[model samples]
Target: MSILITGATGLLGRAIYAQCQAQFPTLDIIGTGFSRAQAPLVQLDLNDAAAVRAFFAKYQPSVVIHAAAERKPDVCENDPEQTLALNVETSRLLAELCHEQQSRLFFISTDYVFDGKNAPYAENATPNPLNFYGKSKMMAEQAIVAINPSHTIIRVPVLYGEVEYLAESAVTVIAQQIQQNPQSSHDHWAVRYPTHVADVAQTIADLIALPAAQSAGIFHVSDSQAMTKYDMACVIAAALGQNASSLVAVPEPTQSAARPYNCALKDTRLKQLGIVHSRKFDVAIQQIITRS
Candidate 1:
């Protein structure tokens, strides 16, 4: 069986690709990104339906993990058209193709789908996104479900792990800032579960390995531990052996798009499926630092 991964150059996509290769060595894997043309990965703009269709026809994958999106909330808010094209339209096209081809689809969603009014959202919670990015993802999720209910939807929160790009993740960005200036401070308002990307990848692999009848629902994969950006920054600083005392904790600043203050998710579904294996924030941070 062949599996195709979109946004392969991204932090989560890269980790998933690596883990799929490592754990399922005999599985055929194809990865696509915007401009990167590395081995096992080709450049394919998901926005172009013709390109996507051609690639799908060529590969004829039995599974497609859709991970490409306009992830930045501000960018999505400012450019709603681009966001719709990438996040919604592309997803619709992929869903239709997957349905036609009888391919199982795995969509990586975010905890931002839920409003911050409720903390530790469950897998079955209704989504009320606060920003265009989140709304776009919610729309995609709905479209995927409507098009093919058998698809797997995995929602994750604030992922951080080893990456080819050091500044790709918020955790690494905070670490870089602290390395540059120890007195750097960050927002303490929004609480998030900084899940490790490796954990998310493993969860996807495990889901793929499961029987089809048992793996076709929404699942939340996140660390049980939640922390604010400030707490995360302090942990990252401490991991780097830098004194975190000087790191300031300030209120969240205003932005173009509204951010959910409590977007932490509870992986009850994953736990029930015996697939929840998230690392603590501090331990994950240390692993990232060590790898770096």
Candidate 2:
């Protein structure tokens, strides 16, 4: 049984692929992406529907783990049509293709589906996205469900680690400040779920191994804690053996792309499935720092 992983070169996707390879070495993993160093890339562009169909028809993968998307909120807001086309339209096309191929699709979603006014969103909560990016993702989620009932949409929140997206979003940002001025205390206040990318990826791999009846639905993947941007910086600082109190809270962005303050999601359903991980925020931080 071969599994097709899109965005295999991405931070989360690569992490998931690595963990899956470790756990299920015998499973055929067809890693696909445009990047050469993305490790087993298929050179498949999502926008090209015919190409996507051709690739799926050729592979006929039984399990599809789709972790690709235009994730940046500001980028999405800057180009709504492009964002919708990439995030929504591409997913719609993939869902249809996966249905025809008889593949079990597991699409990555975000906690941003909720406006953040409500913290610890549940699996069944009504999505009230406050921004265009969230709207597009929620649209994709709904569309994926409509296209294939066998699909599993996993919603993860503000992910970080020693790897790809973390460097861009959290690790590098904190390390830069620490390197520049070990005493600088600014740029904080954005709160998030702060999930470990490796953990989220492993959770996906675990869910896919479960029986179809058990893993098919919406699942919120995140840490057990809710933290502000400052909190995250503190974690990073502590992990790097720096001073946490050296960082200070700054005013958050009022209106730019879109971010949910309380997008922290509860993993109750995943917990019920005995799918637990290192919920200790410090453990995840330490892991990232060690590898960083």
Candidate 3:
């Protein structure tokens, strides 16, 4: 049976596809995308219910990885209605289709589902989203659970990798900045869990490879350790063999969307599933550096 992945053109989706291809070489993988990429893609828009339903019917995916979302907090803030329409409503449609097909749905969620007042939120913690993006994601989570009780909701932290667009990734952006301005000091202040897309992808692929009974319900996927944005910058710098001091601390910039200071997640469930994430910040940074 094929594993169908939505948002295959995006970073997370692409990473998941890559990991699946590497780990499960003989498994069939179908990728859907809004914009075309190197992978085989079915160009179907999630917002268009007809297109999505048709894709679902034709593909008949046994495993559906829902990685598509309007995740930019600022963009979602600017257009809350669009965010809801794309993230929540579209998700409901997909969940319904998955249920009809009896496919296991792995829904990608966010740490932003929390209010950020508490660090390292648990899987069972009540989600009180502090921003529009968070609200939309939370809505999707609820809708998916309502539609398909067999779904797996995987909540992830902010991701960074080498192959990214718009300089949106913290790790990539910091690495580039350090390369350009090796002597500048603005890298040590911003810190996050900084989960590598590869690790996140690996975890998801591993889950999908498991039996249905082994893969169900919500799972928090994050690093074992939580680091600030500043700490991430220092790691990036050190990986490049540059002076970590060159990455200086800067005041927190104003954000259009509310940020949860405590967006970190604890992955006790993932650990129990034998998927312990022990990638240190330095090792993750080096991976990015090597790949970059």
Candidate 4:
């Protein structure tokens, strides 16, 4: 079987692709990236409809993991047009093509779909996005489900893991701040579930290996650890042998893009499937920081 992975060079995509390679060694795993595509990953612009169609026809990947999207809330807020095109339109196109090709699609979504007023959102929970990034992802989720209800959709919260750079991940950036300035102030208002990318990757691989009867529909894959930027900084500070008390905590929402106070995703579906892959943030993050 051939599997296709989009955004293969990204923080989460890289982990997903790696997991697929390790778990399904015999299957053909084709990866795609835009600006950073290298050998084993073809440079394909998802927006080019003709090109995307041609590539799909050539590869005919039996399973398609649609992970490419504009994930930054502030960036999406600033350029709604680009966000819609990349996050919504491209996803819609992928769903259509996957249906035509008889390929099962696994669309990546976000916990940001909820307004943050609600905690531990269910797989079928109603979406009330507070920002463009979340709205675009919610739109993509709807379009994918409309085209094919059997297709799987996985929604995760903020992710961190092995990264090419420290600043590449929202969680790892805390370490950067701690390294740069001991007195840096971090947001203590918003609560987040900073999941490890490797865990999310393993969950996807497990889902793909499931029987056809149990593989379809939406699934939430997230860590249970609830933390804020300040909390993360404290952990990161401990890892770096720095003083956690040196950092300042701002007890209010920060950042240009609106963030949810606590969009904790309830992974009841995955749990029911006996698919569990989680690590303590304090433990896993220390390894991540050490590697970086």
Give the alpha carbon lDDT tens digit for every residue of 1-81 in model 1.
Answer: 998999989999998998889888998988889876577589998888898999999999998999888798999999999
Positional deviation of 230 in candidate 4, in angstroms? 0.4
lDDT of 4 by residue, 24-55 (tens): 99999999999999997999999898999999
Off-target runs (Cα >4 Å) in candidate 4 are none
Angstrom error at residue 271, model 4: 1.0
- Among the numbered candidates, top lDDT falls to 4
lDDT of 2 at 178: 66
Locate the minimum summed-lDDT window of 10 residues in model 3.
Answer: 183-192
Local distance difference test, each candidate: 0.87, 0.80, 0.80, 0.93
TM-score of candidate 1 versus the correct structure, residues matched by position = 0.96
Which runs in model 1 stand beyond 4 Å of their true positions?
A: none
Count of clashes in candidate 1: 0
When 1 and 2 are scored with TM-score, the better candidate is 1
Q: Root-mean-square deviation of each candidate, in angstroms?
A: 1.3, 2.1, 2.4, 0.8
Any residue pairs clashing in model 1, and if so which? Answer: none
lDDT of 3 by residue, 1-292 (tens): 8888888888788888888778878878888888665536778888888988888888788888999889899999999888988899988988898888888899999999998776668899999998899999999999999987789999998886546542656456767777888765452322357777888898998898888878888899887566666676677777888887766676664576877766778888888889864466686668767875
Q: How many residue pairs clash in each candidate?
A: 0, 0, 11, 0
All candidates' TM-scores?
A: 0.96, 0.91, 0.90, 0.99
